[model samples]
Target: MSSVLYQSVVKNYGALNVLRSLDLAVPDHMFLALLGPSGCGKTTALRILAGLDMPSAGKLFIGERDVTRLQPRDRDIAMVFQSYALYPQMTVGENIGYPLWIRGMPDAERRAKIDEVAAVLEIGHLLDRRPRQLSGGQRQRVALARAIVRDPAAFLMDEPLSNLDARLRLTMRGEIKRLCQRLGATTLYVTHDQVEALTMADFVAVMHGGELQQMAPPADIYDRPANRFVATFVGNPPMNILPVTLAEQGIAIGGTPVAIPAARLAACRAAQVVEIGLRPEDMSVSVPGAPNALPGEIYVVEPMGNETLVNVRLGGGNVSVRAGRDFRGAVGANIAVTFDVSNACFFNSAGLTAVHRVNSDGE
Candidate 1:
């Protein structure tokens, strides 16, 4: 069992606390991404797990061993950093075989392992090339090959793809995902990229201000965010959040009623002022006088190749609606928007709606 566990881990620097009693569990062979923006203590947690930094308090375990004070090498972990960390003077083959060489493996065995890892990563043809001679993606693969050759108990990756171009990053995301599945190693990947975390990880632990905000599979994190921060951060265009008053009629924005499911309204009846969340995809331009139509002026329109994003100034706040590519609505034009209440979310003023509320049909 190669599960990585952090029990009430805390890291502090003088008076400034970095990590605040974080308790996390990563199942065996699980690919879990510690995701957050820079300075959120995600990297600190990864460093602690890798034995590069010591925790201020609490136990760290890799499998059944209490590795809280173990050295990096003694922990039997492989780390791939954001820099690729390839040696400029060494060939790709040498780089991949370095760990085995240090372990006193025979040259023949080292060469065989290097060749195997190179072939697995599809970089066998470039084994003779130096780090500088290879492209960014190839160098990244070389770094990965080096780590994989170790066959360590766990793999720690710190923003390993942050250096690649956008196209290469997308390509490598799939490659990394395939590699993790093929090896079935417990991997702890640290990255600020939400797309990478959402698409690759078996589970995602969202960190904010050195605290664990939420941990769950990607779909649940998106559809039902644990709090306002997660709700606003995970989405691409982000959910449109508005301060509204809940009443018997429905939700009201700027004192004007907006259409919402009766069941949702009833569920949040205890809260007077609630923050309503609607994904951009759930809103559309509706015909004037349509049922539950919200009148607003188009603030701006962004035409993506596949769809158009239209920002509307509704009452005191602004909300963006995702429209079809054929949408030719001009900016500043008065338009009506309709809501899909089935997918709506309601949060208290403090920004917490623990359970997702059902619509009228109980969906």
Candidate 2:
């Protein structure tokens, strides 16, 4: 496996811009997930990498070889699409070994490879069965087995597990991650689900409005977002972004200065207007005036058994606060919210967000 680079690639559709000067790098044997909401161009990026679509401008490389103009078959890459893309007429064994067959591999070798992948994928029992005989997850495994049989230079997966239920998706997530590790194949995965991106990939590329915003490890993207868009889009409940003003006394959120230790306030230089980004875990309900505390009302309570998400309204907007194992809160109840300044992130007036220190708390 070798590095893959998309050098300032651009794509357009008539009057619409699907990808804007997108540049990305996936290291050898690295599992990279392209994450963003629908219409963000993550799918388009995967298509370009697999050579199903050519870039309007800029170059693409697989290892050191340029592949910008290469066709899908010429790129030596296997792609697993969200639709499964399986042939209804083919048996599971034949489906899995289709790639090897296309390359004119000997019958004995093809059978050996099919048996190996089928055993790994636990689909050996279903080899004689057609795709319709298997469940969604089983069919997905067949799709993955096809990709693995060829031992291509890389694998491009486009939301291959979106159709499975929650439990099945979780099971398949571990299966795919473990398979990729064993094969040491450089994989570029595309998904709109943040949890999928966070849990499955070694690194994540967060995209927005067809532009690449940030690319880093999952923990880095979650704890230290490059900007507000990445911060809000990459988390489970997402980060809480609020408008604030920097006054001479301290920081005023919604016209009220939050009480914090003098030592902490002293470090912040007053800017005309600054916004604060807080994770749900950053705010705690506790004694008033206990280090950056603000009074707010609990507007919504969503119980998850292990944790309760309390939505608090303050500064003209509502934001969720995560409570420990089990903390009770009712709607319209007044609560004292205190921020863990050490875990806080700051953004400028233009809403360009940056985590204050990646090594602070949650380091």
Candidate 3:
């Protein structure tokens, strides 16, 4: 496993600009998720790294070696695609051991490596089965086993869990993260699901419209998004961004006085209009005596066993607050939600973020 760096990478298909000049780095042995919507070029970026696609313009480096012109096989990388991409004619054992065999490893070593990975991946019992005989999750496990057995420079996974059911996807997310960490395999994974990105990767790169929106640790991306897009895209049920105005002294939501700390207010003097980003989990169903509460009416309640999400309509927009499982708010109920000041984010109307600046390491 090695450091993967993409410098000034660009990809275009005739008039469609799939990837604008992009620069990203996956440090040695760190799992990084290329996360974004379907057409945001995350898959393209993985293909470029895997040598399946050539960049229109850029320099790509795998560790200290430049591999911009290398073929897929020439680069020491194994990829697991969303489709599993198993050889239908081959049994699971054969598919998992194929990479080692092709690299001309001794038969005994290949068998040993395949057995080791198959055992760890819990796919040993399925080894004798063909792809058609195995279930979706089992086939995916085989694909991952093959990639792991290769002992390649890096593993590239492009939405490898997308085809599985929710439970299987969740199961594989933990498996992949644990497997990568145990082997210390530098991995670049691509997925549109924010949960997959946040859960499996040490670092997450959020992309939009063929551009890298922000790159940071998952916690940072969730707590301090670089922009409105990243804020809205990173969290579950999405972070709520309310359009507000900033005066020289304080902030106002819908022309009503909202108490913002003096220091934060001063920091926002430059932006006349801004959006306050609040994660659903950061806002509570205003506990008994909490102040700085925003008034709203309950619009919807969603219960997921462990928690209840209460969507409330503010004057202009709406925000969702994550309530405890015991919370029993009825629809159309009057409520006041309180945002945790220290945990909230703010961005100017231009969409560039401001909250990440206040408590940065500079603090």
TM-score (all chains, Cα) for each model: 0.95, 0.94, 0.94
Model 1 stretches astray by more than 4 angstroms: 271-273, 354-363
- Cα displacement (Å) at residue 12, model 3: 0.3
Task: Give the number of colliding residue pairs in candidate 1.
Answer: 0
Off by over 4 Å in 2: 259-273, 287-291, 354-358, 361-363
Please state the error at residue 107 of candidate 3 in Å.
Answer: 2.1
Which residue pairs clash within candidate 2? 259-292
1-363: candidate 2 lDDT, tens digit per residue: 777999999999888899999999888999999999999999999998888887888899999989999888988899898989988999999999899998999999999999999999999999999999889999899999989988788999999999999999999998999999898999999999889899989999999999999999999998888888988887769898887766666678876686544544554453333667889987777654455677778898888888888888876478888887678877787886877666777776666763363356534
Best by lDDT: 1
Order of candidate numbers by TM-score, starting with the best = 1, 2, 3
**TM-score, candidate number 1:** 0.95
Model 3 lDDT per residue over 8-94, tens place: 999999999999999998889999999998899999999999998899999999999999999889899999998999999999999
Lowest-sum lDDT 10-residue window in model 3: 354-363
Candidate 1: C-alpha RMSD to true structure equals: 1.9
